[model samples]
Target: MSAAREHVIADLRERISLLEGGSARKVGCLPFGVPEIDAVLPEGGLAYGALHEFAGGGSGAIDGAAAALFAAGIAARTKGHVVWCLTRPDLFFPALVQAGLHHNRVVFVEADKEEDVLASMEEALSYGGLGAVVGELVRLPMVASRRLQLAAEKTGTMGIVVRRWRRQTEASDFGQPTASTTRWRVSVMPSDELPVPGVGRARWFLELMRSRAGECAEFVVGACDDKGRVDLPSGSADRSNTSGRSVYSR
Candidate 1:
């Protein structure tokens, strides 16, 4: 806790951030590429070497898929390979590819239960040179999430927990803390209709439920494309009114 000692530690953190390339939001941080959104996040963006949680708004099928796709897009933004652990085989690679997470860069592990999934994710995160490790869970206890966080920190890998609840009641577990760096609740929104009468791009209602270093915020963004980028809605010519963005706090 000495002043000089603290300064030395800070310098070392900054140096590490620089070595990571574009992950220099503050320290262990990278911009989400959304100006307004990044402005409010700690380090001005999501942090590396930490655990983040994503969940659906309800028990709806599309809601869970939206959360997974959102995490995939974030992972796509990072470098190296991605390991996603899930109990179910419902994930379709073609949709992930459209979200910028190319099929080749990803490795999927199918487990029969949550314990296996968590174990696999922790192992993947411990490995060096991986971009990210994702674990799908219906209920993540604080103890489990903390272990994952510590593992990710050991090597600077990112950990994303995609909470996929099998029942509406199970999702209630999300109300508790997991000591994660950040948490988000994603909901599907009606896509914009083209003049030709068909779907445009997918849209999402992103709720920033928890931020260790930021205030809670909400946004409606166009789903990630082939390059892992989130954008304002195509119809949003102006955002003086947030283009329909909202924020909530607890």
Candidate 2:
């Protein structure tokens, strides 16, 4: 890329970062605040102006709910309203609030087909007004994802694609390549143990499945708090290897 083009992209990134309630000095990425998790990414945070892919570890409802909450928490942290496009109308409103995303901050688009969902996501991402755009679908073709990535890059908006499968067999598609900047898989883990007789905060097993210029790693974290933030449990360690190898290499 030319120097002028690079400068323009950087400026746009910083502008969008500030517009999304981030500090002026911090541009191009959204840090998760946990040192261990942030250290693995090349940007020390989730990059802006990019497309990210996420999916549950399994097809079961519990795993799927975990994945949805993960995306919801991310959207919750941004400043402006969020546009979420999906074929399903079954997202739990209260759960989103618990994940720190208020209902008023989200504009949901219910499309009739997967193709329409992708188209809506691409359009919303290009609008350049929202903090982020989210889409739920079972399959994301490379071409469609590339279009979304380009739209995000053009406007400095983040795009999140949550892969939701109704059948286990459909999940095989997730292994295919895409234009996403990163890919993640979230699974529900046993809740934290409480000294008393009640349940503690939920825990999650997070897998960084792919990254363009970062190491793949895993983490055990307390689920999203009311502020849409996840924390490394006390005494837990980061799972990145010293060599920073990709998960696929393992």
Candidate 3:
């Protein structure tokens, strides 16, 4: 083979190898606050290198605090640092610490604009050392989300986008079309009574909205401990209505 031809072939081979490696590469897992939710996910936790959207019904009504705490709990459990980007400057840090996220493990960034939040989140995810990146954004354009997804994939880090309920609904309605491997919606449920009873137990509904592997189901999980880690709620009967939807009545 001519020297130039040999060089071209070698370059082509290297490109092919990279493509294969990327496909086979596994992303890190962000363990959900709930064990059952983690079990349902393919990786036994939130898959890394992908976009995971948490959709809620309305602003301030979507349980953003609980959701943030949940993500924080995962970061704490994994002993990984969390880069939290929020538009609202008032994040309940004490509550987050109570939810199992250590104050030292979290780095809070308050972004004034949605674009800045996304940009900062992408940078955190790409920094390659953090366990997970959590961003509270109102809306994420498809193109921007795709870029963030690619960045996550490159670093093998988990990216979570918490969409405010009052923002553009299309981002959650049409599935945002990012490189995310899975999507989930979390809502607060009435807590089961505890024997000691201070705040009682915390309950939540975890709905797997979308998944690349295609097995999606709704599960009820209860939070335990001072840090609010979740587990299967005992004595709670599984009730499925005629429409095949699981309903938990308070």
The candidate scoring highest on lDDT is: 2
Tell me how candidate 3 scores on lDDT.
0.66
Ten consecutive residues with minimal summed lDDT in candidate 1?
241-250
Q: What TM-score would you give candidate 2 relative to the actual structure?
A: 0.84
Which candidate has the highest TM-score of all?
2
- Cα lDDT tens digits for candidate 1, 6-84: 9999999877765664333212675778998897797788898899999877776677888888898999998888998
List CA RMSD, all candidates. 8.7, 9.1, 9.0
Q: In candidate 2, which residue pairs get closer than 3 Å at backbone N, Cα or C atoms, i.e. clash?
A: none
Candidate ordering by lDDT (highest first)? 2, 1, 3
RMSD of 3: 9.0
Looking at model 3, residue 94 earns an lDDT score of: 65
Q: After superposition, how far is residue 143 of candidate 3 from its true place, in Å?
A: 1.3
TM-score of each prediction: 0.82, 0.84, 0.73
Q: Which ten-residue region of model 2 has the weakest summed lDDT?
A: 241-250
Each prediction's Cα lDDT score?
0.81, 0.83, 0.66
Give lDDT for model 2.
Answer: 0.83
lDDT, residue 150, candidate 2: 92
Residues 1-250 of candidate 3: C-alpha lDDT, one tens digit per residue: 8999999998888677555533233446766655667767777777767777775422344355455655656556653677888787666566676767777877889888889998999887766666678888766777888888988888777788876544444434435565567766666766666688555566666678788775797877764345546787876533221111111111
